[model samples]
Target chain A: MWKKSSDRFEYLQTLVTEFQDTDIEEAKEQVLANLANFAYDPKNMEYLKQLQVTDLFLDMLTEENENFVEFGMGGLCNLSMDPECRDIILQNSGISLVTNCLSSQREETVLSAITTLMSLLTPLSRSEITHPSILHCMLRFSLSESPRLRNLAAVFLQDCCTEEQVAQAEQQMQGQQTAVGIPLPQD
Target chain B: MAAPVGNSSGCWSVPEVYKHHEQRKVCISRPKYREGRKEKAVKVYTINLESRYVMVQGVPAIGVMTELIQLCALYGVVEEYRPLDEYPAEEFTEVYLVKFQKLTSARAAKRHMDEKSFYGGVLHVCYVPEYETVEDTRLKLQDRRRYVIRTAQNRAREKEKQERSNEDPTTSDTTTTTEMTIVEYDKTCDSDNTGEAQQTSYMSHYSSFPPLPLPPQEHNFYGHTNQQGNIQTEDKMGTLHNAIINTKQQLQKSTSFSQNSSDRDRGTEQRVTPNQASAVRFVPRTAHLENRKRKMAKEATEISLTDVSGKNEPLIGPKLPEPPKLDMEDVSLNTTVSLIRNTMKQVESVPDLKPLEKKIKPRRRI
Candidate 1:
């Protein structure tokens, strides 16, 4: 097991170095996919942290390249499950970056972003992660036509928000619907 | 007198006659009344000394003509105004030519209005030279219209290009491009796999070559696997182990490539031999593991043992036998009699307390 872990660590370090050395978009994509896969294993968490892979992933969240952002968010979603990695993400202001990804057109990217947010939400970060606009956005997402998006949004609301907060959001949404001249059906 | 020179039907005019000394002599031979007409001609020339036209640009979109006239009214009366109408409605912005009553008034308007902000844009006012005829101004306006139309078309094209790039990932063409690139990349990896397969084939000819590394892993994790692989029950774990080892080797090669590049950048003459590279990589991996193990052990000790023990405790306890019931009727009879006697004694004290309460209420009244 120790030998296997060392091998995995060396492999991930090589991928990061290759990613930095290459200028080709295709090569970068391959490297990022590999990094994201390695990130899923809990044993690689410390190795990745030493390589400053978290910062690299965070940097990709703002990239114009769709693949870069998607793979980056995927890696973050995987790594954020570890408590140490979660703390690192929070300290680096990863919440705002993950929040920005909520509007991504890619379903996989958005899903990963939501999970990353859920993982990073501690008592201290509850207010930042559950901002009013974010709550409203999630409320809208809960009613999405796609069941996947709707289910994820429902989970986010249930896990991240108090019942009173969710009820208040529903009232606000109803008020907006009425102001737009759309009537709601009574139960 | 040069009067006849001015009144001549087909002869030299007064100004023309004045050009030649001999012609002037001939003009002087004419009547004196023509002399008065020459004075009027000279007066007309002085009155037409400078142009009164002013070119005003940067007119606002709303009510441009009216607003321009109102803006110019402050300096002098506008004798006539012509706003260029050659530009198409959508592309047209404002530029006007106004004829003020005097040259001095045109100069004043230019000084007061040039570079001043009007509506949303700046106004540029300048005098139109006398040599610039209406035809020249019209041609200039047509040229401006063409330029504006060309630029508007270019802007629309650029905006469309940007939108296409932004929406590329969702489009089928982008997916095809990415797929094609991945297929090309896989071919290179396949070549490497074929070499490895050839080596492994000698061990067991019946076994098919191991599936390519790149495709199966990505799809498996993404839950998009489309094919199932057959593995012997005995070799299932062995194949999995081989696959892991292969991936790890590939990663080592990639990182070593970067280290080589970094070495080259540092202007070092020495090349990194495989032994040195492996040694350098090995040291960090072991050191990192040791540090992690230490940290985990420390955390384990820091956690209170009571917390772990408490979590293992059960909510319910063992059942015990119930106590036997006792007959209290005989023993309670004397206790009740004593309780009644004690109550009667207390009641006797209540009468004494009543007098104190009455005394206190009367003192309050006082």
Candidate 2:
């Protein structure tokens, strides 16, 4: 079962690419294939650690923005939690392209793109700074009127900053700054 | 600026300095960069035309702006705007007709006039707004745009071209200096050797300048009159003839491009020339300046070389004079991409004789 699980990884990627523009049933096959390959396979564990997973996740960034019904925000969340995918998200230029999708029409698409961006910054210094300009652009987007945007920004701001960086920002804010969610963990 | 005062010699001696004031403005307040609000903010661009530098948009002139604005609007930034009064439908109706017309033809006169006044107002609003209100600021930050094609069509008026190089003429006449930039290009690639690029560059100058006698004269007068572009008008031989004439004129401008190239030097055109090159004023652009210059220079160099050679050979396809670089010869270039860099070899002459036909042939193949 474990050997069979890893063997299907290529098929899963193929399914994701092929059905990316397809209907709900076809997309479920893609997700199930990925979940099985990722969750059940043990012999393929080392393969799971490679940058190829990142390439696969990054490919989803270009998937039809119209197909949220197929691979929705959940797909984005699943990829974010994966370490290999997370590292790639931080390093790849395509991650910015995903974050850029936050400006997309669908709320789910926007949320997922933002979540992926925020996820990279969650484990601080895990990757080199993807882009300083993008971070500033995201912050600019966070000031938006969309409640979804506000909540995502709030969550991202809480999870993203390192303790030392936040401390400095706090000091700069002086006594007037109000507290937000979880403060950065002390090293 | 000096005001001349009559001194002992009876000739007005200008005072070098009056009440000296610094030329820079100090901004006391930053415009409200409203954050974290669905509140709209304007992106303002101020272009100091500086009498010489060209207005810049990006690729494909009008097309780039349309794409950029369309994408932005699709993503829901702010409403991308067209200039307050672009062309009235009537006059604009004939644009397709004029499109076929050579750019330098008389047909472009009206369209160029409209675009000038329209762009000037839009540029002005972008630079300054009297009111501090966001609306006022937004109005000022009209997101006005202009595109600068990589080609030579970036020149402005004819006089501007003449005046630019005419400011200094010594460097303009030298073929060695003209060859310097071209020679610097890496040779060895068949792509670079196509010899068509030179023709395009020459023709590009013509395309950019295509005689506009009206816009400079219009001076802020944009009247609305819709003419041409009806079903009957589209089929007329007269329209086609006019377009071919216009295109031919643009081609002529290409051949005579040297006459006005110095004029275009003020705007995006100068972006091509080094600052030092700008000081070398050439004659007003004329058709075939490049051909004449290249032909003349080759003749002079061959004449000098013929005396050294024992036998007389036609200058045509004569062994290329070893250019400035001696080290570059026989350096095995790694790839086709790298070969374009070795421009010191016998750089082929440009070739694109019939641009429309070439442009059309590709679509048929596709």
lDDT of 2 at B128: 11
Candidate 2 docking quality: incorrect, acceptable, medium or high: incorrect
Off by over 4 Å in 2: A1-53, A63-65, A68-76, A122-148, A162-187, B1-366
Query: Candidate 2, residues A1-187: lDDT per residue as tens digits?
Result: 1146444444334443443444555344344333322422222322332214334444444556454321333344434433334444454444444544654654445555655564444324323222333333344344433333444444344334344444543343332112222221110
Q: What is the i-RMS of every prediction? A: 35.6, 33.5
Off by over 4 Å in 1: A1-4, A182-187, B1-366
At residue B57, give the lDDT of candidate 2. 16
Q: How accurate is candidate 1 locally (lDDT)?
A: 0.48
How much DockQ does model 1 earn? 0.03
Return the TM-score for each candidate structure.
Answer: 0.35, 0.24
lDDT of each: 0.48, 0.30
